[model samples]
Target: MAVLALDPHIAPPAIVLQVADRERPAAGGGRLLPSGFLSTSGSQIVDAGGRSVRIASIGWNGTDSPPGAVLAGLWQVSYRTVLDAIVAGGFNTVRIPWTDAGLDVPLNGYNDRLGWIHTSLNWDLVADPAPDANGRYRYVTTLQLFEKVVSYAGQIGLKVIFDHHTNEGTEQKNGLWFDLGPGSAGRDGGVKGRVTAETFKQNWVRIARTFAGNPTVIGFDLHNEPNGEKGLITWGGGGPTDIKAMCETVGAAIQSVNRDALIICPGPFFYAPPPAASGMDPGFATPSGNLTAAGTNPVKLPIANKLVYTVHEYPDEVSDIARFDLAQSGAAYVDRMNRGWGYLVRDNIAPVWIGEMGSSLRTQADRDWAATLIGYMSGDYGNQGGPTFGPGQQPISGSWWLIGPSNDPPYGIQTEWGIGNFRSEQRDITDRMLMR
Candidate 1:
């Protein structure tokens, strides 16, 4: 069921980290991502030397959950071991989804937050060597743990993207980025305080400044699946529920601090606009993949080529009459790609990251859907069209939905007793999905 990458006891081989700075020379250890900072060239994400880079990322969820949190498996295994396993498993990048409430957990409070990590396996997390006067300093803040996660990932050659999964450990069902309002259901129902648009942007700015020169910290995924429907989360209208406007606003704010930071924007659930004529059919789009609105009113940021669009494609294996195509491949999903946001790749609009996607390898429908979707992004169109993996037209790249320590039926990347482990089958699909 679950496959262990290495012994959970031993740490990965210790290697000296040569930080990316003028003070030190560029380090090399066969890093998967390019050495320099990343920028965009039309549709391609290019390194400083202008070589194209494909973002093969895996979304690591759970810290975005309610109450205080830590990166999932740290309680069962060492953070070092789990992170090393990510690289060993053949992934180049990792996306850490976090909530504001989790970020506010203080150092001393982490004693309770880290759960079982208080054991000797991850001593550094609970208490680090400290100044003699203070006996021992406890580096126990969730924020500190988050920074350590970023630092070690970079040291070991994996780039990171921190996603604002939710504001206060509560899902944004209301579709408003600013205030979920009173009786918002979770995170103590604004007992800590409500999340205003300005405060949200400022929170991101603080995170950006925290990792200012860290090359390993690549980008900020502004929001996770602003999956609100038409009446709720519209794009570009500049209304209260305008996610497009919010992305640009928050993105530009983060850039004011970390200018080189890549601003990733995810739109609302589906773009079903009112019929141009009285009786026309409503349009459909993947979750957070509302590029129909973006096509006409593209997100304009302060910096050039710094904007990237992200979408989640949690497609059902079988077609639903409710949503057309659904990556079922019968109607030439590539044709849909050409007509939809996926067209951004062929047209070289901006880089599109499939931010989240996955399925159980059990059923044939699931298998076919996974293959077709990954193939589409990798430029294979599954006999629908020719592959377009080249400079300027680099195939679309993205993070798989998640990796968890559970069987999770249709979507888990890990199998039974999955801590310090992963599913070999999922790993195989991930290998194929990664951009070469």
Candidate 2:
């Protein structure tokens, strides 16, 4: 293991420095941290050995869907095949998004909601279980299936980031973290039911205990994009409804079960109008919040060296893409990021991971935007034809929005399965991803 040089001006916070000195024991009389576990040091994510590692990852979505299933079933490929494809695609991590209800219920119970869309289980690829009292075969539970997925991913040398994709058992469209309602409808106007914050925390506690010692399961993304009614999107203010408070509450719970677990908190989602006559669109929105102000303070956890701030970015979500041209320059784009979540890295407060970002690259403008964003992540300021970060400012890490078999416009990274060919739209994006 080798140690990378950190920005001298941007020292890690006191809590992180203390953890590195105490928890990260020098191995073989060398500065190497350890292997297996991962923790944050300032704007960098280091392995147990303390070597800097970037999370060039892709989201393996589907856990939020009925039955906690992954896209592997839709692709008719084994979960191993999907994991292999992720590694072969030059990614080091996989973000697995799952729902609380899906994990608590039995596979069959949740699958019933899949109706006609559910794929036949590839039993050989998954877990094997004993028959029930009636001598009938019983499929593995969703929790068991996820454990299998994590185990296989580790076998293939891929890091797993468990994401709480939703509180409901069905599709995730509601922006709230734990929707406790009398009759709340989903984004599709269907009632998916509700869950209390207490129930949400309990499920996470159970999840943390389940994979407490698993090194492959490095990070626990507390919630997917936390946005909804006014109270739900609370940043640092808004009392108990504040997302920062929720993160601290849930993060502490996870750490109690697994101290080494990295707690990732996604920023709030809101629209920010672009500069007047700046050629950018007005309806531009991102799952990032400006935490540079006095009221919007940075998230501080009781535990050390484990908190990671995250945000989601998308092109279509922006108000106007035509005006926000990336071909000419990336100044506007970089500024938008700064106002969103870049401040964390810029100020050296904590490691900021762009948890989700994707584009179809359907048009030249889309392709340019992708290139600019990728260049920024890679620390290639010149590639975007824009101003670069200052001496102490470090490049940030990010993961693509999704990788699935379905060709759902720009979000899908692959059209088919089995690690063959990715969609045409992914050609440019894949090239920019860091292998290690």
Candidate 3:
């Protein structure tokens, strides 16, 4: 219907660009690109045509988890193959977790690992990785690598949600949306990885601009698992550390550039059931994945129906999952779910996406927790208002924690570092969960 501008200066890798420029469809003269532009409609995320779009995704982690600072499985598997596995696994989207660690590594560029490819797998990732004759390097920068991944995924009919997992390649060394070095948290410092609020927003803006109007790049999971000792990542405090404030600020900035991108703001770790009345307070730490403040102070974005609140539920040994006895559907558990972020869905406030959820499934408790979570989230109990989308809307959507080779139970979707074989045991759970 309407024209959307994908980055005019830069485009997907040459090989995939041909695929993206295929018979794009919308209406009238036809869409310049795929018609995946998304927006919110009363707690539902809908595609350009206004049909509900469920984000059934699988996380392809490692870029932000550290050690490699690149997408995992590339050491042995091509990203295309990985995408094939994801599609076969029945996921419509891929949650690409990344960091700012390499973004400024290049002297004149962002992300030293530009247009990256495994040297063994593709010619693009040359051993030297240095630009040659026409200032064009045989190797791609990491950002370019990311772009190429998105381009190909879109070609094969998959959406992507870029999750800013950590400040650096390592992890969330600090709870805030920043990483600090010995000196300041204000400027760029790779030594200790300085990522201030300002820099965080700046990095996000850069990313948003990079993929501004590409419909394949559906949403932005702003940050992952906001938690800290005292109250470093509390929301609605109206202060800098307030995660709600951060989401609003960053989301506004993103919509400013790409108004169509869905801004996913997850619940920070500070769970507590909200007070029944204004007189009551849910106190500090409870079992729920916290978004208590938002029960009153919702994340207001520059664009309406574009804010989707999210949560990462591990249920066992993660956060206060045990504290609430969530596996058994305890009262405390349901309450926390409501006050935390569930109300957003039930009250028709905003859509809620479980940004992350996984387990080793080693213990009976683990399996139970996972079952309970997906069941509640999937509207198995539509009468209780656990989570239920509107008519023509998809079931409460989410991404399986990962297609992994991780040690933290790894969200194991594949066996050999995510390249060997499918971890069907784990996928059995996901197949039931996401393949609705």
lDDT of 2: 0.61
Model 1 misplacement above 4 A: 1-31, 107-115, 127-139, 180-193, 271-282, 317-327, 382-387, 391-393, 409-411, 416-421
Question: Could you tell which candidate, 1 or 2, scores higher by lDDT?
Answer: 1
Superposed on all Cα atoms, the candidates' RMSDs to the truth, in angstroms, are 6.6, 11.9, 8.0
TM-score each candidate: 0.81, 0.77, 0.79
lDDT per residue for candidate 1 within 1-436, as digits (tens), equals: 0112222234433211212221221111212677557889878888888878777787776577764566666555556655665665556778888776667664342344434343344555543343235343344667677787887777777788888887777776655455534323323334444676676788888899999888898888998877555245566656555677788888888888888768998856653442332111135444435666676678888996788888776546312413543455444556655555676666677888877877666777667667777777777763554336664545677787676654454556765322236777777677776545
Put down candidate 2 lDDT per residue, 3-23, tens digits, no spaces: 121232343342132322223
Which candidate has the highest lDDT of all? 3
Local accuracy by lDDT, each model: 0.64, 0.61, 0.64
Give the better candidate number (2 or 3) by TM-score. Answer: 3
Sort every candidate by lDDT, greatest first: 3, 1, 2
Q: Write the per-residue lDDT of candidate 3 for residues 277-370, one digit (tens) a residue.
A: 3222456443345665666678898687788888877766444455653443444556556666787777777888888777767677777777
TM-score ranking, best first: 1, 3, 2
Number of colliding residue pairs in model 3: 11
